[model samples]
Target: MAVVSLEGLSKRYGNHLAVDDVSFDVGDREVMGLLGPNGSGKTTILRTLTGYLRPTAGIVRVAGFDVVQEGRLARRRIGYVPEDAPLYPQMRVNEFLAFMGRLRGLDGQKLDVSLGLARKRLGLEDVGETIIGRLSRGYRQRVCLAQAVLHEPDLLVLDEPTNGLDPRQIIEFRTLIRSLAEHCAIVVSSHILAEIARLADRVAILLDGRLLAVRQVKASGSIRLRARTDLAPGIVSALRTAMAGVEIAEAPQAGGMVSLHVSTAEDGAVDQVIARLAAAGIGIVEMSEAGADLEETFLAVTSRKAFH
Candidate 1:
């Protein structure tokens, strides 16, 4: 079962519809990225998923519990870090995390274990006595993340978690997120395309309060072959016949070189393609796995006509 599910979820404020029929799911141990610009309802959808805002229409379920009908149960399975980290400036890191643990109904040995694990995982041991207000932006974000995972919820929700971090900090944050995904599903909402591409297994693009598309950021069993010479039409046809269920399409290229993207469901497709191209006397220049084209897709869907 999906860790988080949204079906025809919509949210409105007065006459303004903030989210329109947005639906998607985050599977167990999966990283689902929500990609869009500011004011595109990414935050609104997240708020609804966390049960902070009731959807104006449709349903949201987290771990088989309805977010509205069973808000407490559903929320217990979710650990959310909003765009802004909610921290008490005066409180120390350890104190704040302990307070959050108590609020989540943890106590005694259970709370102690949870706190110890969270602190160790987020590298907060050295900063345990440091005031939250005195910590750097990156460390503060880590604290927020630590608290969210205190109870080890089934689903983790993060909204613009790296907004103010430096490059090194962002890289470190990405590593931490990936490590967490080994145990639970994660939903990260961000307008930055590169971050989403690097962090998510799949991304759902939102625009103008509607879902534009959901695309896989990691293309499994896909490779790109660049040749100095173009393959003959016959060779292309022969390759298609040789590899059933393989899709070969030309990718945009420059300097008169040919770049073909080959995607297949079967293993060893790369070896097969290489062998055929060599047999056809095509001079292979480069062969690499195809990465995400999320930027292209995002631009295509969000494009608007130029004004005179």
Candidate 2:
């Protein structure tokens, strides 16, 4: 069910190496978030995937077609929405979509059906006759998506699809992306961390032209263990000895609490560690899971080199 695959894909400028031996497989019906800071080579990777730029090395496959060798087939099967979606300013929405559909080799009832679906799914039904220049930025983005998907491409490549959208528009965009999950594989690249955590089925963080980490949308194992001891010595050593992989995360004497983040190999180790410390004469004030969210994970991994 792998719809898109990139192995050792690399691109470089004259003196600077951009994407270095980057590789990953995108499965069917997946919404993958591509994350990175500015100038992190994210745009380069997307451009290469869309065939706007040929890679200096490695292979890229979209819907079982090689991006370079079978360039036409690959391009035909992919719906690419760049950060700045190209739209003819004077063209009417429906007219532009029809033109785009024709370019994709879609015609007759089949093409009509595709347009219908795009309009309904992307909430562009009422704006069909509006000129592109008069539409709001959010609606314009939707129009861009409508054009990209007017022919129902099998693989959707969206680079910062929700970049300039308002909060309401951002939510609507997320809903549209989730609904499209049944038909095509999607790759959405954005620097907004929270949005990725909420919308992505998986996440890949890129930095300085390299992929730092790739992860599923599973909840990270996180805990905030507060050290509370009535005695003067504190429970610092007790924490270190009893809990493996536990580090001092926060310690506030005014609050009479010392918070530590515990990372253990096995599951449910937090409760056990807390029980052990309590049994050994240490006091427990409060225990809760901190924000080990995707943003935190993205920051942690991307700050370092690639973790494979």
Candidate 3:
């Protein structure tokens, strides 16, 4: 079941379209990545879903409640952590958490139990007495996250939650987000491609305010081959002659070598290519096959068509 859905969602400022005709769905108990470069309209979509800003057109829904039409209800069921989680400067950490709990209609023993749960979930039990202004940036980020989920909202929308965190903090944050998926749907937008790739079960890629593609994050290994230095002369010509219509996807031409990336599972095919190259007197540079790199797939899909 989809916990978060956007239908033809669009946001515009006068003549400039910040997000255009975007649509995607995030499933229940799943981590969905909203990814793009800076200003790729990723944040715009997050803001709309959070109901902080109304969309120029289309709808944002959370757990079946329309974000704009039923914002109060939708907001109650969703936790939001914006890019900069603005906290009061002087509020004591415990007091701040109480305030956050109250905002979610939690109080007394109920609030106490809920607050305790959030604190433990976020590893903030030890710092409960620290002032908001006195904590380090990493801890401050944790506080922000703590407040967002204080209500135990069914959905969590985080905009760059790992931003301003150290490497260790980032790891902790990742584990925290993963833990949330046990009971809530999560949608996180980040420019850190590898981080998202690591955590997300599905990905929605946007560009120029348009949805480029939505795809499953593949984990299967792949094969990569590098030509040995002894491949005879005219090896490039040999490859071209042997595999007509085969496209050279990538491999920088350097030191008089032409390397190429191919997706093949046959072992002898590679050996045959090398043997043929040697017979043709074409020098073969380094060659080996390895796991299918997702980064390579992402670039290849996003890049312009390769020139054969």
Candidate 4:
């Protein structure tokens, strides 16, 4: 079953609808990237998922529990880190984490084990006695993350997690997020397109309070094929017809030659593409495996005139 599910979820404030019938799911151990611009309702959706804001319509479920009817139970399975993490500057790192753990109902031996694990995972062992106010921005963010996972929630929600961090810090944060995903599902809401492309297994794009598209960010056994021939409409159609279930797209290249990117999880997909191209008398100048271009997909979806 999906770790998190949203069906026809909508949220409104007065006459303004912040989210409009947005629906998606985050599977177990999956990292879902939520992408959008300002006023696109990314934060609103996260709030609703975490049981902070009751939905104005439809249902939100986490681990089979309705967010509204079973708010407490659903919330207990989730750990949320908002854009600006709520922290106490006066307290030490260890002290703050312990307090948050207690708030989550951790106690005695369980609390001690949880605290130790959180500190170890977040690299906070050396900073245990350091005052939160004296820590750097990156360290503070780590502390916030540590507190969130103290109880090992089934789902973790992070909003603009790498904001205000340096390049090195951002890289470190990405690694930490990937490690966390090994044990639980994660929902990352961020404006950074590149980060989402790297971290998420799939991406859901939101625009103007509506869902634009949900796209896969990673593909196995994908290949990029470049041909010297000009790109014709028939060529693309023929390729698709030849390789069922394979995703094919024309990628922009600096040279005059046409570039096609093909992706599929099926075995021998490359050999099939080669044979099909040969059969079609299409000359292949170059062919090699390539990763998904999420930016291209994002642009195509958001730039549609109908959406505007």
**Top-scoring candidate (lDDT):** 4
Q: Across residues 1-308, which tens digit of lDDT does each residue of candidate 2 receive?
A: 58989999889898899888888888998888888887778889888988999999999999888889999989988898898889999999999999999988889998899889999989999999999999999899899888887767788989888887887687667777878877888988888776776667898788888888888865444666665535324555665677677555554566565556655543344444556666678766667655657767776886676854
Predicted candidate 4 versus true structure: per-residue lDDT over 205-249, tens digit per residue:
998888999898853467787765475354566668887777777
Weakest ten-residue segment in model 1 by summed lDDT: 299-308
Residue-wise lDDT of candidate 3 within 1-308, one digit each (tens)? 57998999989989999998888888889889887888889899988898888999998889999998899999899888888887986998789989989978998899999899999988899999988899988888888889988998889998988888887677667778888888899999988876776568888877767777777866432324455434423455675677534334455556644556654332234444555566777654466544545566556656643111
- lDDT (Cα atoms) of all candidates against the true structure: 0.86, 0.80, 0.77, 0.87
TM-scores for candidates 1 onward, in order = 0.76, 0.76, 0.74, 0.77
| Superposition TM-score, candidate 2 onto the true structure | 0.76
Error of 3 at 281 (Å): 50
TM-score of model 4 relative to the true fold? 0.77
Candidate 2 Cα misplacement greater than 4 A, ranges: 219-290
- Measured on C-alpha atoms, candidate 4 has an lDDT of 0.87
lDDT string for model 1 (248-305, tens) is 7876567767777778875445556766666766566788766547777778766852
Candidate of highest TM-score: 4
What's each prediction's clash count? Answer: 0, 0, 23, 0
